[model samples]
Target chain A: MLEVSNLSVNYRGIRALDNISLTLSPRELVGLIGPNGAGKSTLIKAILGLVSFQGKVQFRGKPLRRQRQRVAYVPQRSQIDWDYPVTAWNVVMMALTPSIGWLREPDHRVKQAVSAALDRVDMLPLRHRQIGQLSGGQQQRVFLARALAQQADLFLMDEPFTGIDQKTEAIMLEVFADLKRKGKTLLVCSHEWGQALSRYDRLLLINRQLLANDRPQVVMTMENLHRAYGQSLQTTMGGNAMGFSFC
Target chain B: MLSPLLSPLAYEFIRNALIAGILVGILCPVVGTYLIVQRMTLLGNVIAHAVLPGLAIAHFLTIDILWGAFVSGLLSSFATNWIRAQTRIKVDAAMALTLASFFALGVILITRLESRLDLDAFLFGDILSVTVKDVWQTALITGVILLLVKLFYKELLFYTFDPLGAQAMGLPIQVINVGLMAAITLTIILGMKTVGVILVTSLIVGPAITAYLLVKELHQMMALGGLIGALSSVIGLYLSYFLDLPSGPAIALTVFGFFLLGLLLRPVCNLNRENSVGKKLGKKYRSQKSEVSQELEPDA
Candidate 1:
């Protein structure tokens, strides 16, 4: 379980995220949806302590920082340099680095874990290929494999679905369900809403503050959509359909 | 050809210079691979220039020049980091400010103190004038750097590739970063005897970029870059001996020439073409996607 309380973040003396609070239980998948510049990414960064925030975040009744290995994070695709000369296997193996000990290569155990994680993403065949040569979807899968290799109970992914192919999207949803079945808690940031928004167990709709925190059907009401999107609702939702297609 | 090449090896100073050149060649490219991948080649140049003030002050105090160089380099780099962190100024502007100010202070000190030391030797190292002590110092530093890199290769690999991911994993990222900075400073200090501050960055950057274009993995890039660097140093030193050119410039030029050669010959030799695995993956992914998309449409 995770709890965030009174989380406020300021950027250039402007409030990027207002005092916000949320909690998640074990075996739950929460989708974080917000308008552009709604501090979706900032919220995740603050939780991870990668940015300054005036708040407290607790994981499993303890401070998040103290439980680092228990939580795995996959940063936005743009945050990484794809040109770096590393294989998909290399990226996945980074999860086992702390356990691999210093001055040593991956042993048979670590290699097995890396290979298994890569296989889960169907990227094992491309293990030794340079990561940059992979398509954008494959690149996303590689990062997912890395998080899988971490074997963490909590997963925080920033925009894991953006710019990915349909197949990758299906694989990601499947992995989320698989992780949920394994009693892992996941918080994924996404900007998509057509039929895809129904997949999450809960949706936390935010715009600088917590607007809604409930089941996807209950929280995605037109009123909440208006509050979250403001004047940009028509632009964001595309032609006044007024809600997610699945809804 | 043999006599022209063999003649330089007879003198002790020339032989010492040769040894120093080879060490610098091997070390710079290995370290430079990190700099290139991290997009911090400019940072290396900044630290190289910043070492000058330290060099001048150390000369004035009649102490070890390497100590001053290392200290000043670290100070400037750390100062750059501090400024970037504390203020809104970006890393490039901060580096520019520090690079200019530190280098200016060094020039002023060299002029004002009247130390009787040749600034040219520091700016453009007179490698041909190297003593055995310089060679020994280089060897020690090279050994230490290689050892540290070997010990921390995985950590460095992860850190260099993805800092945020590594930090999330509770890796001591800041400590790793500082350790890397110290290693780079040590490398630049050792290189001062061969390429000097003005041309030292080229020595660091040239071979790494050369190797990057030819390899698909970081370790391979480092190994190939080391070989290229070593060869360039020997070849450049030989050219200096035969052509009566400046050793630093000759080596820098030779290293850059190797990079250019790698660039030109890549397509000819298929040196940088995607490997078999990559090609196979590309074909399979395209075919699978097409099949899937066609199934979804089922067009007339």
Candidate 2:
């Protein structure tokens, strides 16, 4: 479980996140959605303590900062250098570094975990392939496998759906469902629109501040959309008769 | 052929120079692999040139120049990061400014002091004149750096690959970064005497990149780069002895030569084509959203 209270972040004196607060329970899949530059990513970074923030974030009744090892973060694909000369296996093996300790090689047990993680994401066949050679979907799967290998309680993923293929999406949804079943919590940042937004158990909509925190049907109402998207929604709607199509 | 090459070991200075050169060759590429991956090659050059002021100050204070150079090298990298963080200037511009200013100060101090330090030799290196002490020092530094790298290999790999992820995992990212900087600075110091500051980046980046073109994994790249670096030094020293050329330039040129060879052999190695394919796939995925758009379409 995670609890955030009165969280605020300022970048260059401009409020990126303001007086935000939310809580997540185990076995929950939460989608964080907003327009571009809506500080969706900032909220995640703030919770992870990657950025300076004014707030208290607690994980299972303790400060979140002290419980970092229980969290696994999968950053956006753009943040990584695909040109980096590492195999898919190498990327997954990184999750075991802390447990294996420094100066020690990954033993049979560690390798089995990495292999099993890769296999879970359907990437075991390409484990020896350099990451750069993998497709966008494959790349995302490799990272997903890495997150799985971390065996963490909380998952914070940034844009895991972006640029991925349909198969990857299905695989991810299955994995998310499985993770939820296993009582793990996930906070995923997404820019997806339409019916795809319905996949989450709950939605947290924001534009520099918490706009709505409820079921998708409640959060995706016209009034809430107008408030968060401002004039952009009108332009995006483009005089559609049926209002904005769910797709 | 073997005799011609083996004959150079008859002299002690040549032996010392070869040992020192091989050590520097092995060390620079290993550390430089990290720089290349991080796209911080310019930082290596900045640190290399920044040591001049330290060298001058150490000379003036009658202290060991290596200590001064090491401190100065680390300071320049820190200063670069500090400037980038505190100001609007980007990292490249900050590095260029730091490199030019520190180098200029070193030149000025060296001139002002009119010290007995051979400016030309210091700038260009005099490997043939390396003493036993130099060889011993190089070996010691190489051993220590390699040991540290071995001990922290997994942490460094994770940090370099995904810094934010590693940080979130509570890996002490800053300490890891500082440790890497220290290793790089010490590597530059090791090469300063063999390749000199001016050509040190070649020793640092050349073989690593050469191996990068051929290898698929980080450890493989380091191992192959180390082999390439050692070979380059040995061959470069032989060329210097046989043809009477400057050792630093000879070694630097040899590194370039090996890089060219790697480039030519990349096709045969079957790595370059895969990279290009990956690029093509990336571009196609970016330009066309048809697959995603179709899947997202609501039921008719």
Candidate 2 docks with a DockQ of 0.40
With a 3 Å backbone cut-off (N, CA, C), the pairs that clash in candidate 1 are none
Please, what are the lDDT tens digits per residue for candidate 1 over residues B159-240?
A: 9999988888889999999999999999987777798888998889999898888777899888999899999999999999
On a 0 to 100 scale, what is the lDDT of residue B274 in model 1? 43
- For model 1, what is the C-alpha lDDT against the true structure? 0.88
- Candidate 2, residues A1-247, lDDT tens digits: the string is 8999999999878899999999999999999998889999899999999999998999999999997878989998888999999999999998878889867889999999999999898776567678887788889999999999989999999999999887889999999999999999999999777678879999999999999999887888899988999999876556452533442
lDDT of 2 by residue, B1-300 (tens): 678778989999999999999998999999999999999999999998999888988999899999999999999999998999788898999999999999999989888987667777777888898899999999999999988888888899999998988888888998999999999999998887887878889999999999999888888889889989988988889999999999899999999999999999988887565556445544645554454233223221
- Return the TM-score for candidate 1, rounded to 2 decimals: 0.94
What candidate 1 gets wrong by more than 4 Å, as runs, is A240-247, B1-3, B268-275, B278-300
DockQ of 1: 0.52
- The candidate that wins on TM-score is 1
Kindly give the number of clashing pairs for every candidate: 0, 1
TM-score of chain A of each: 0.96, 0.95
